[model samples]
Target: MKKAKLLAALGICGLILGACGAEDDSKYDTSTTEVSESEAVVKEPGLDELDPAVSEELSKMGTDEEIDWEKINFNKRQYKEYIESLDEQETDSSETGESTLTVVSSSMVDDNTIEIVINNTDASEMSELTNGFFAIMMDTFSRQLYLNSDYSDGTNQPTIIIKDNAGTVISEETDFIEMEETE
Candidate 1:
């Protein structure tokens, strides 16, 4: 699935970026925006204004019955600005190439849990590699949720489940990854 590939690629890139250290963000200064009390309060853009694809995905972020729409909708302006800020950065995909760990599907199973199914690849120590990817992926994924002021649950870190190609969950929990022993 293209979505799976894109998410895996993003996770890989996120790992690379973490090792590379934080980039200089001084160019985008917010000090100038010192609106006085007399200035009218401006209304920010809603989720409707975001890229349809992203908006749709974020709209379905939380629970099915009582989705995170309320929280996400309240911060549509924040997400819009966040996405726009990301677009400002330039990245070359050719440098990263392809990721060895293929993600079958990364789904949000609950408000505080993310289930990621990764296909078994030729990489040695598959479990070890999967654990590493899980940490990186969870950390990266949590940032988006943690960005929302209203999202306060599960130690402020969503639990991540990693599964093998056969759709068997091999790892569960977060921060500290615990693998399920197989026969």
Candidate 2:
């Protein structure tokens, strides 16, 4: 019951943030600057190594505009309080076996990308837990960005990356990695 409610709340928050993005489209500069042929070459992220489906998904989520990272704050007082409440609710944890998650830190790789590092005691169970919560985290983070920043240009969609304690990547929630152009 609690899980269902939490998911619903997160979904609502995502919708609110999506609305927020639409309002700030004017903040982005629309001026076109001419660049030389050499300067116009854009470097892409190494995503060809991933499976075709995964690569395709990431591309759809990628935004060309850079995000203004200075204004994003997910650990503000209200959100911190909310996070604390979530911790308290975990006393009635649904899982039976040992499944613990400790968030190490979260930071921006770029404007639209938020990487959340966590230490899960059960490495074997990491995939299951990550898969379960990835959507929620993505929505929550994206919503938080809109709530905290006035610079949302609709390109503020967050791509969440989850990595385990041993520096192993557990899961990625976005399909926006840059792919090489096939000749």
lDDT values of the candidates? 0.54, 0.52
Tens digits of per-residue lDDT, candidate 2, 1-20, equal 99999999999999999998
lDDT tens digits by residue: candidate 1, 1-183:
999999999999999997766466566676787778779676776544754644655656333643343344324345434433432332212235543445555555655666665554445555566546654544454445444533444356656666766867666765544446999
Candidate 1: residue 106 lDDT (0-100)? 57
TM-score of 2: 0.35
Error of 2 at 16 (Å): 60
On lDDT, the leading prediction is: 1
For each candidate, how many residue pairs have backbone atoms clashing (under 3 Å)? 0, 3
Q: What's model 2's overall lDDT? A: 0.52
TM for every model, in the order presented, reads 0.35, 0.35
The superposed Cα distance between candidate 1 and the true structure at residue 181, in angstroms, equals: 21
